[model samples]
Target chain A: MLKINDLHASVEDKAILRGINLHVKPGEVHAIMGPNGSGKSTLASVVAGKEEYEVQSGEILLDGENIDELSAEERAHKGVFLSFQYPVEIPGVSVTNFMKTAINETRKAQGLKEMPANEMLKMIRQKSELLEIDRKFLSRSLNEGFSGGEKKRNEIFQMAMLEPKLAILDETDSGLDIDALRIVANGVNKLKSEDNAVIVITHYQRLLDYIVPDFVHVLYEGRIVKSGTKELAHELEAKGYDWIKEEVGV
Target chain B: MSKYTEDDLREELKTKEYEYGFYTDIESETFPVGLNEDIVRAISKKKEEPEWMTEWRLEAFRSWQEMIEPEWANVHYEKPDFQAISYYSAPNSKPKYDSLDEVDPELLATFEKLGISLDEQKKLAGVAMDVVVDSVSVATTFKKTLAEKGIIFCSISEAIQEHPELVKKYIGTVVPQKDNFYAALNSAVFSDGSFCYIPKGVRCPMELSTYFRINQAGTGQFERTLVIADEGSYVSYLEGCTAPSRDENQLHAAVVELIALDDAEIKYSTVQNWFPGDADGKGGVFNFVTKRGLCEKNAKISWTQVETGSAVTWKYPSCVLKGDNSVGEFYSIAVTNNYQQADTGTKMVHLGNNTKSTIISKGISAGKSQNSYRGLVQVSSRAENARNFSQCDSLLMGNLCGAHTFPYIEANNKTAKIEHEATTSKIGEDQIFYCNQRGIDTEKAIALIVNGFSKEVLNKLPMEFAVEAQKLLEISLEGSVG
Candidate 1:
């Protein structure tokens, strides 16, 4: 579903991702765990086509097509999604209106008409029910004074609305409590299918417990230093990243 | 990230042209360029005014000659050459129109181009429209419907001749002559505007709107709008102005006076889109307007304005709460882009006990423009328990633009409760990236954020006008970001 070859990226001439190579097929979940400032979020943002990070020497492919030149919005239209670590607050714009605009813009880019109002409302109702979001929550300003859990849940709500082909959950569990973590992980588990993929980038194995991954990779200083199955997460969580740092001869 | 920096956004902002820049082709009777007592008298005489009206203009002209233009506003412009401007210009033929069909086709086409088809407006919008072109009221629609309800809606010239008692009773009462430099000039040489009077205990059946268009070249448009709501009455009046593109700046000095009698309520809204200069700030309109309303006992007055165009704008819509328990409200959204400069806000004076006022102002500055909010809240000694709440916010796009706030409060009565809040923020690139990642482009992203910022003020507008204001906000900021 997605491929990255020698993905070297930087922001403002400060190198972040030195070299990254990854391949993920449909119907699979991949977990990329790293210490703080190890380029995990940078990978997600670069793949999402954030213009601030220049792809110094790399190529990203979606369905065998090079997407290095695509803009963030274009990537969005092509079914790429990024759950932000900290959602931007847009006051006075309701969540429903924001989703409507996002959906309509994507449809417009794909040469499709806007979804009928009734269908959009029905979808909103169904999706909010799936995520256990209150009806009134959909009418409030987009993340403007929302609690941390609400913001993460709202990000997932948007992800559900877009139904992207490749979803990158960047630090999605950073601010979630136990209950919120369960709900969010449950939502992500239900959204998984054979035709889409999810890349969960996190700093701990706590989130992996709820949404089990097919494979785990340890990112150190921008490169993947270790790759293994789900048990690798528990092992790393038990021993901490200091062992990995020693193994990498840092 | 760095590829689409603030410099790129500023460059893109310079390419946007004024949307309503097309000039209308119509022959006009233009007065020669100059300003003097003789010119002022000629304007009054040309309107066929009564003796008192003519004398009133002469007096205003005398006061104007003695007063110098004030430089206190947070704006700098090459002072306009008042003597080089033609004070009066009107369509050569002013034919009495019994129906919309009898109105001149050229004038109707002009309005149609402005998206205000009088025929459509009369049938659909249920709005009584007084269309003023280059200083003369060309067409007045729905007069019969308004007249049936004992509502007096007509051109100021017509009102002077037909309802002199009402016109004489209220004209210049709120913003009297010598109130300011521009007010004196407008009072001296004002040609024509709408005059509406809601009868006692009558609610106006429809919105009273006046659309002012400056079609002729080189002529200054000075319009005087007077609206009076009698005791126990209510009215909503709308004023919209647009000017054709010109290479040299044109002057527009207007005076608006509103009176809400005891137990009456008046809502006045203005969507001013005069010609803003080109990217290099070579031409546009100098909009200097004086708008004030007086609220009597138990009366309420509200001013809502969405100003988006003009090279230099100096306007303050104010309210004088004269009667006990009266209310005053001002909601404004001022947008400046490309070299535009706007210094606009409101003044609320509480002179009676328990008078309350609310002011909400949102200023958006893009490109190299400068937008400022200057407001004053005065609580007189007699105004016991007077309350005022004010919020002023500014949003800037690109690093070259500027936003400023100057709020003045004078509380003579210690019991007065006054609160003010203000904030300034830039349109962060992160906000844009967020929207972009959601499949919205940079342009749409900016528009979305701007609309969100202005939602509070826009909500105060009438439904139809609110939609128009939203669209105007988008158009004003289009291409303002890369």
Candidate 2:
């Protein structure tokens, strides 16, 4: 469902992703693990079409179509979603209003009429219950005063609302407590389907316990140095990334 | 970003004239471009003012001549060459028609071009309008119906002749003729504007509105409006203005005064969209206005404005809390894009004990525009237990634009309590990307963010005007997104 060939991206002349090659088929979950500054988050940002990053040479294809020229919004309409590392606080805009606008905008791009208010409210309530989010959170300003755990959970809740074809979770477990982490992972696990793909980018293997991945890739210095199965996550969690850096002579 | 020299910056500031600039070829009765005792008397005579009104105008004119233009506002513009501009320029043809159908087609066309629906069939229900073209009130609607409720609504000129005693008692009472430079100039040669008076113990039956359009070139429009709410009465007055896009900057100096007596309430709202100069900031309207209201004891007055146009706007619609337990409120959202510049806010003067006031100002600056909020809150010695709360926020779209806040607070009574909070922020790229990732384009994202910034102020407007103001904010910020 997604392919990245020799993805070389840089921001402000500083290369962050150097020749990254990856692919994921439908219904599969892939996890990318790396230490801080190892380009794990950069990889997710590059895939989401952030304009600040310069893709010097490479092409990204989604569903066999070149999408490098598409805007972030166009990519979203094409069912590509990114769970932000740090959710933005948009004051005075209620969460429900924001979600409704996003949902209607995506539907409009797909040439579909807006969902009825009652139906939309019902879906939101169901999703909130699944994500363990209180109904009052839906009426407050978008993440205005939410804690770190609340923010991460809200990101997962938004992911559920958007229902993108390819969901890229960037460090979704970084600030979550044990229970919040389980709930977020459970939400992502429940969203899995045969025609969709999920890529979990994290530094810790603890999250892998909840939403197990079919494949794990170890990234270092902007390159994917090793690829293996779910056991690879446990190996790295025990040995840590420094052993790999020493083995790779970096 | 490319480094530009001084010449490049100068070129960047060159502005173009936008769409509203088609001038009509109608003849007009204009006074010479100067002011004197005779000119003031002539204007009064032209309107057939009552003897007492003529004397009152003369007194204001003399006081205005003695006052100096205030230099306190955070605005920079060449002092207007008042002696070189025509102040009273009315259309030559007078409407002799006994009904709205007989109003001149040319004048009606002007209003239509300004996007104001004047046709009887298109008029909104429960909305009465007074149309002011150039410097004269051409036609007033729902006059008979309004009169049936003892509500007197007409042009200032007509009020002077019809209700001279009322006009004489209230003119310049709230905002004196010598209040400021522009106010003094307006007082010296003010032409005509709307005059509304809700009788004692009566609530106005409809929304009273006045539309002011500047149609002639090189003519400076000085309009004076006065609205009075008698004891226990209630009224809502709305003012909407538009001017033809002009390459040469046109001067508009208007003064509006409002008075709410004991147990009365007044709500005044304005949607000011004068011609903002082109992208380069070459030609537009220079709007210098003074608007103020007085709330007597137990009375309330509120001012709500959405100012999105004008090349340079310098106006402060203030309120004077003179009666105990009276309330004053100001809600404004001012947007300046391109080369437009605006320095506007309100003043709250508390003279009676237990008075209260609230001010909320939101400014959005994009492109190379400059927006500032300058406000003052003064509590008198006798205003014990008075309270005021002020919040001013600015949103900058890019680094090129500027946003500033200048708040002046003075408390003389030990029991007075005042609180102020202000914040300035740029629309970060991450926020834009977050919205874009939700299938919202950059333009729509910018609009959404701006609307959110102005939600507090916009929500204060009347229902219909709030929607109109929201649409205006969207259109005004076109191409402002990165």
Best-fitting candidate, measured by TM-score? Answer: 1
* Global lDDT of model 2: 0.86
Question: What docking grade does candidate 2 earn?
Answer: medium
Please provide, for model 1 over B258-296, each residue's C-alpha lDDT reduced to its tens digit, 9 standing for 90 to 100: 999999999999898999999998899999999999999
Lowest lDDT 10-residue stretch of candidate 2 chain B:
B1-10
Write down the TM-score of every candidate: 0.99, 0.94
Best model number under lDDT:
1
- lDDT tens readout by residue for model 2, A10-86: 98899988999999999999999998998988888778887777788988999999888887888999999999889
| Stretch of 10 with least lDDT, candidate 2 chain A | A45-54
Task: For candidate 2, list the clashing residue pairs, or say none.
Answer: B14-B280, B15-B280, B15-B281, B15-B282, B20-B245, B21-B245
Ten contiguous residues with the weakest lDDT in model 1 chain A = A49-58
Give the per-residue lDDT digits (tens) of candidate 2, residues B294-337. Answer: 99988999999999889899988898999999999999999888
Candidate 1: clashing pairs of residues: A51-B1, A52-B1
The regions of model 2 sitting more than 4 angstroms off are A113-119, B1-21, B24-27, B96-100, B120-125, B480-482
